[model samples]
Target: MTDPDGPSGTATAVPEPPEKAAGTRGRRRALRHPLARFLLRRVLIAVLLAWGITVVTFVLTNLVPGDPATANLGQRALGDPAIVAQWRQDHGLDKPLPQQYLIHLGGMLQGDLGVSQQSHRPVSQDLAETVPATLELAGAAIVVSLILGVAFGVVAALRRDRLPDHVLRVLSLIGISVPTFWLALVAFYVFFYRLQITPGSGRIDPGLQAPPPVTGLATVDSALAGQWDVFASAVGHLLTPALVLALYTIGLLTRFTRSAVLEVLGQDYVRAARAKGLPGRVILFRYVLRSALVPIITVAGLAFGSLLSGTVLVEAIFAWPGVGQYAYKSATTLDLPAVMGVGLVVGGVYLVINLIVDVLYGVIDPRVRLQ
Candidate 1:
């Protein structure tokens, strides 16, 4: 301005300084909605946690008693120093532990899970072939768990102190108390051996020609390939193990859901909805059940994650080719790289599931989003 005070004003309106203008733009660019920021924070934390888990797994595998080279080469090579040395050098086992860890971490980052000492194939490939099997089994189990658990829970809640509630409670208690391995064995004995109603073991009947390995999940791939016989066989083989794995989750979810629904039914809003001439079923489903979903979701997510990793025994019992079975073999043979790979994958699964649950929390309850 030519003068600090003009005729029409005490001071002419000064244009914002370039620095101030740029700063304002920067702040505007930096600002993000609360939900976006929250999600970003969670993702960062999950990444860090996954890395920590990998490191711990690596260290623990290294600390194990057996030498990987010896495990790989066996006693015959143990007698030959040259062979052992060559094996160690070839696999990078000759390097220092920290250097090995770094190399392993780098390879993992690039999606190379290293070669299996026992199988002599890419660990990632092995997991790729097996993980789908586990996923299929776990997926079936979860569906069963959710349907039965929620149904029984709702029935128990509705009937309160009736005979059906008592019977459900008793059954849930038994389900929780029974060991998974024992259940799997008993199921096999009763359903497969004695009754012969289900297939004995494996993912499909050997007599049935398998469909092309499209998804590595026999049932899904067979269905996709229009191979109904293979699909039927896969389903028959899967039923027993899936049911066994689902039982524990069903019990836990049933009890939790029952308690949660009971608590919600006693709430003021639920009673208010009922008093306002709302249909009983509508109030129960829309108000009571929706309010009770948070805990149920939490448990379900955790259960699915657990099923992914904890099905080793069940997989072994059922002879299902899954990551759990692979992990078992690797651990028994002290295959460090394979074991480490499984650990990373399992831990990553758990973290990812928890992240999903957290996101669901925000979606289901807007208050969580605002926070």
Candidate 2:
């Protein structure tokens, strides 16, 4: 052949294009930062999961027995073919399923969540108003649960087989086994109806108007606006439902934390710390608790995410104007757009919580980020 191999009988190496080489170098540089790599990986996974959520919600709503146009139009409007057709066309329900889905996805990307069939307002706007309320409730619940759960868990672990441990274990079992709805009903009856210690249902007293909507959380907004009376009212109104919602999570975290601390207690390093003659409190808090934090954080994250999404029954019972209530209303009314928005919000909550947990893992234990 015409000396294709040249003098050394070896082919020449092909040089990568400058653009390709730059991209490769950029990737390598990005990878060198463990935290950055971890964040990027987590973010990509979250995005993928979000996409799957959209797909699943879309398909399920479509498969469900109901026509959006008919549901929104009512019986009188559905009697008019022209009105029905116009409504379908206006909502893009006239398009092919694939095209409709693409349009829906595109609108979601652009922050347009469609118009709520029930409210006649933008779905995004409705969610914005409701989500903050749920956040406040869920936030309060998580704080209460974390404090009680961690304290009880540590005590249980320390006591091991003593009477305190047995009592706490029984209480936790009751908390876990009891249904939230029934507990909520009983708590509401005993606290609000019988004892009258807590205020009646709703976020605040009807007499005082809500403070300016800086945060949409009544307590926060009231405090920000220097409405101390309103703030106190908001807190009182919030306490009962929040505590009711927290019971299950408190139990779950208590059991899990006990296990985690017990596992850490068995580690060689923990034994070494004890052998070093450290104070009992110091050894327990400094070594066992610190090492057990990663698992505790994981459980807490999942519990918080569940609380945020699973508050429908509690919200309904308490008359709390929150995302859970909104979702329940939408589902009952067959408001598909609002339902989808709620689905997205719930799924996004889990994703964000998981990302936060992952980042916390890296922060608490540097070894986690290396993977």
Candidate 3:
């Protein structure tokens, strides 16, 4: 029905069809699901946490004993006070605290991490180059932790107080007790120096130069460059650090998984699963494994985050070039910007990994999405 007063297109401005209306409502409801809401909240929190990390790092790094510019001058610029002061003014280090914060925040928002006084390179570039190496180490460590840790945990749960369980308990305790630096020292010395077998330290052997950066990770970049020999050397270098990191994490992961799985194993669902005549492997792997996933994921995320900051001793011991090593060097040398940058990035990783873990909760347990 046309109306003379109606605007443009259809004179009556025909209403949406009821079927289409229902479809729109359904789509809206799906978007408004609890999981969707939870994920949205997690994202917001992560952003806030990242900002907080940046702020804290910014403030603390500046709060160090010496001024950024003056300290940067060191023995070289000791003769030129006026030049140092001019440099400080030019870098905005002489600005008021609030102004400095604002400038830093603006820089961050623009993805500019600013320059590192020590390296004379932009912080963003330094991070972009260094992070891949750490990530490769982290990835390998996590893989080892997840595989061996979860496997041992399941074995302990299944075996209870048997020899396997007892042996693992001792191993876990020993792993937990071993200092990172100590383990790394022993591993390096015995394997590299004493035995004269494995390559002692660094990402690659002395004579073997890796192909030009592809992934920035020696192992990955080597593979990409079709240098399998370099990749193999990288793996060997990776073994000690990965094992050290994994051993420490494995104890926590294994113990947590053991308890979680053991708890779920006693649940009625397991009995019902058994009664249904499902194979033992199927029941354990499907029903039990699914239920235990949340706790396992929790530990894995924590371990991964810990590994980022956790590598100082490992890197120092093995001369591995990583973020942890950078932080350690920065701290020892009073390179506040580098130290703070590492802290901010590491803290941000923790926040992001935790968010990812929370998202996994919905995936591993559908009940999280029901509400």
Please list the residue runs of candidate 1 whose C-alpha ends up more than 4 Å from where it truly belongs after superposition.
1-37
Model 1, 1-371: lDDT tens digits are 13222333422366566786566555444445666766877888998998899899999888888777766676888899999999889889999999999999999999998999889899999989888899889989999999999889989998999999999999999988899999999999998899998898889888888788887889889999998988889998988899999999999999999999999999999989978999998998899998899999999998897677658999999999899999999998888889998998888888988898998888788899887
lDDT of each: 0.87, 0.89, 0.81
State the weakest 10-residue window (summed lDDT) of model 3.
Answer: 1-10
- Model 2 RMSD in Å is 6.7
Question: What clash count goes with each model?
Answer: 0, 0, 0
Error of 3 at 268 (Å): 1.9
Q: What is residue 278's positional error in candidate 2, in angstroms?
A: 2.3
TM-score of each: 0.88, 0.89, 0.88
lDDT of 3 by residue, 38-63 (tens): 78777988888888898888888777
> Which of the numbered candidates is closest to the native, going by highest lDDT?
2
Give lDDT: candidate 1, residue 225.
Answer: 96
Model 2 lDDT tens row, 1-371: 13322332232265657786566566667767889878888889989999999999888888889887766777999999999999989888899989988999999999989998899899999999999999999999999999999989989998899998999999999988888888889998998899999898889999998999998899999999999999999999999889889999999989998999989999999989988999999998889888898999989998997687558989999999999999999987889899999989988888888889988998778788887
